[model samples]
Target: MYKSNAFCRKILCGVAFAATVFSTPTFAANDYPNKPIRILVGASAGGGTDILARALAEKFSQALKQTVVVENRPGASQTIAADNTARANPDGYTLLAATNTNQAIAPHILKLSYDPLKDINAVGLIAKVPHVLVVGKNSPYKSVQDVVNAMKADPGKLTYGSSGIGSTQHIAGEAFNLATGAKATHVPYKGSSQAHADIISGEVSMMFDTTSSAMSQIRGGTLRPLAVLSPERSPELPDVPTLAESGIKGADMYTWYGLFVTGGTDPKIVELLNKTLNDALATPDIQQRLKSLGGEITPMSAADLAKLNKEEFERFGKLAKEANLQAQ
Candidate 1:
């Protein structure tokens, strides 16, 4: 009896030791982001992605007790920054301020230096911004149906510009084509700002762009809103009808913002990022700032993001093939 009790005590001690060994990393995350955290933005500054990246970085900095630096590596449908993050150290210092364009859409289209799903671990979703299909204020097409009619009438004459090829806006436009059975030739630009610029100057007829980038222009009479792609009209633009209301359905097509890091980063690190980001997202300043930009903050766990990413990739992949979109 004495020997059995001693063995039981030893076994309990060993189990406790094993538990501590496995659990220490999680308890250690409170000390994470001790160094300056690099938040990679896949687009140039001043665009929606950049704006949100900076906004969240500022909030994360204050909360995490570390400087959250926003780095721009814009190129190739914003895959440059995605690839950079994929290849970055797994130490939690480098993270991608990812968007649907770079995280979900571009991976399906752009031949990149890294793998979106395999090379990166999603931290969490930052926010969601609805898109507006807008045209020049002077354009004759006033509504979504009118644009579709014109496309059907001429097939490829009316052109729409995007931030770049394989971007969310680009794929959103193609998805619109898939829904409406009206194909529009896609013209790519360096960024949404330039795409909006071209639309303003009538260099491009229209674009499916983030509401934040096109809202002021639409309100100021520079661009005309054809439709809001949300299931309902946006609070900022309550007058615009949804694409579903205009005859397109089955695609929500909203622009999503997320944070990610190179895969193989400790799961503890990923959860730490999720906690920091979700906590920051719940704050009033970040919430209001993102809201004012027409973005809705959504804090999801890494596992949730992983599952959601697979769904989005499947969704866009199907649409891309259906639209015969050439992936590079």
Candidate 2:
């Protein structure tokens, strides 16, 4: 009888331990973000991603009632920050301020220390900024066709600039040449600013850049906008036509910024984050602030963003192959 009683108590103790272990997740959920959160960036400070992160951090901190900090981890083609975010704990704190290059293209271009898609769980898209085909204000190429004519005439002699060898700007310029039958030699710089400088100084023929980066130059008449690499016209540069209207319907390319946590983050937590992000973007203030920066909010679920990231990465593969881009 004593043995039976002791066994019963043991079983109860086992049950109690199991319940506590299972309830741990609830404890996590209840006390999520107990401390300040870190939103890591894979770029230099004051860059587009950094700016957007600061803005989001301001509003997100209010929403979550916790201090959110922005940390920039530049260089190695953003591998440093990407790896950091991928390796962070899956609790609701650390996040990657992801972009197309880091999340989609980097895996294909060069080897990375961590698996971007598998190691990181997408939170949501932040903003989408289209690249504009900009030339020096005094250039003779008045339109996309004119630029194509010049490129076809000069072939590799007509050089264009890009942010880097494996950048979206590089891919877009290459793809544009492929689709439009323009054969310009690609001249890559360490960053868009360098390329834009050369273009403004007429050292390079042309370049495609994000509206935000090129906005000041465009408005200041230093860089003339020929076409925007989007399916539609940019509200910031409404006068410019989509690269499609210039006869290349698919020349449209964009720079997208997003949020992510380490993969295998609890599904409920991921969903909660997704909903919070979408709700944040839906806010009139956020939308207006983003739009003013020549971008639009692109709210999406974690799964949807992941699917979109994969599809876009794969699609860029086809475009990259078609463009005959040499692997770097």
Candidate 3:
């Protein structure tokens, strides 16, 4: 009788432990997002990144039944905001709205406090906006070939403006130089607005600005887009040609945005976040807004985003070396 009681007790304890272990994840997922969630943007308010974040926050709030907020931390090539997110508690309450500048380019050119791949896990990709080669309306250069010829004629005379050092714009400019074998000076500005200002005033020769950022100027006839630095032509500007078509190869670039949470976050939470994000992207309102911003939405799973993050990191490392980009 004593042996029988002991065996029964052991079986009950084992069953209880197994149940607890199996049910924990479900509880965590169901109880998740009971509090407000905040997404950190590495750019200032009203910028493309911030705008995207805000738009998603509204959708996230609606889907999750929780208040979602966007916080701007805009500096250090977006590393500041990235680091903050990396250091936040892995509770799914904090997220980073990251761009290629911080995820791929800045890390190659700056000494960061956090490891982009290890310290933060990518939740999913949001959208990508291609860069367009633009010059002031009054500029003499009218085409990609014209810019290439002028740069070849005066190796260091032609100048291209970028948002900042190690920015996608800067790397795009360098990539153009590498592909075309033409040298042009780089003028780094504090932000794209400043770069646009200089380009409009003819202080800078040209700029590889994102279509979203330069759309207003392009439509206002203050800026003339020469070609898109993308694999294909932009739907927003169907008339514009791609750099490849214009004889410039190996210079395709885009400013891609994605969501990331601190490393070691619960996989269930990450899965939920990815699902929520994809749902938001699928909405008609989101699709229309992103389309208006010259963005392309391609929903990707968490694993897919992780793979892309790794590939972009490796690709940028090689490109930076070939372009002789140095950490500042």
Candidate of highest lDDT = 3
Q: Rate the local accuracy (lDDT) of all candidates.
A: 0.82, 0.80, 0.89
lDDT (tens digit, per residue) of candidate 1 on 227-278: 8888988888887888888878965578888888988887878877788889
Write model 2 residue lDDT over 1-328, tens digit each, in one string. 9999999999999999999988877788777868998888876665567778888888888888889999988655556788988888878788888788777765677667888779988889888898899999888889988988887777788888875666777777777877877688888665566677789888899998777667878888999999999888888788888888888766678898889988767777777777878888888888887886689776788878999888888876676566556655
Question: Which candidate number has the best TM-score?
Answer: 3
Q: Write the per-residue lDDT of candidate 3 for residues 1-328, one digit (tens) a residue.
A: 9999999999999999999987876787779989999999876665677878999999999999999999988777778889999999888999999888888888998888889999999999999899999999999999999999999999989999876678898999998998999999998765676677788899999999887678878888999999999899898999999999999999998998899999978899999999999999999999998897789999999999989989999988898887779854
Give candidate 3's whole-model lDDT: 0.89
Off by over 4 Å in 2: 1-25, 138-140, 189-191
- TM-scores for candidates 1 onward, in order: 0.86, 0.84, 0.86
Off by over 4 Å in 1: 1-31
Candidate 2: residue 227 Cα off by (Å) = 0.5
Instruction: Give the clashing residue pairs of candidate 3, or none.
Output: none
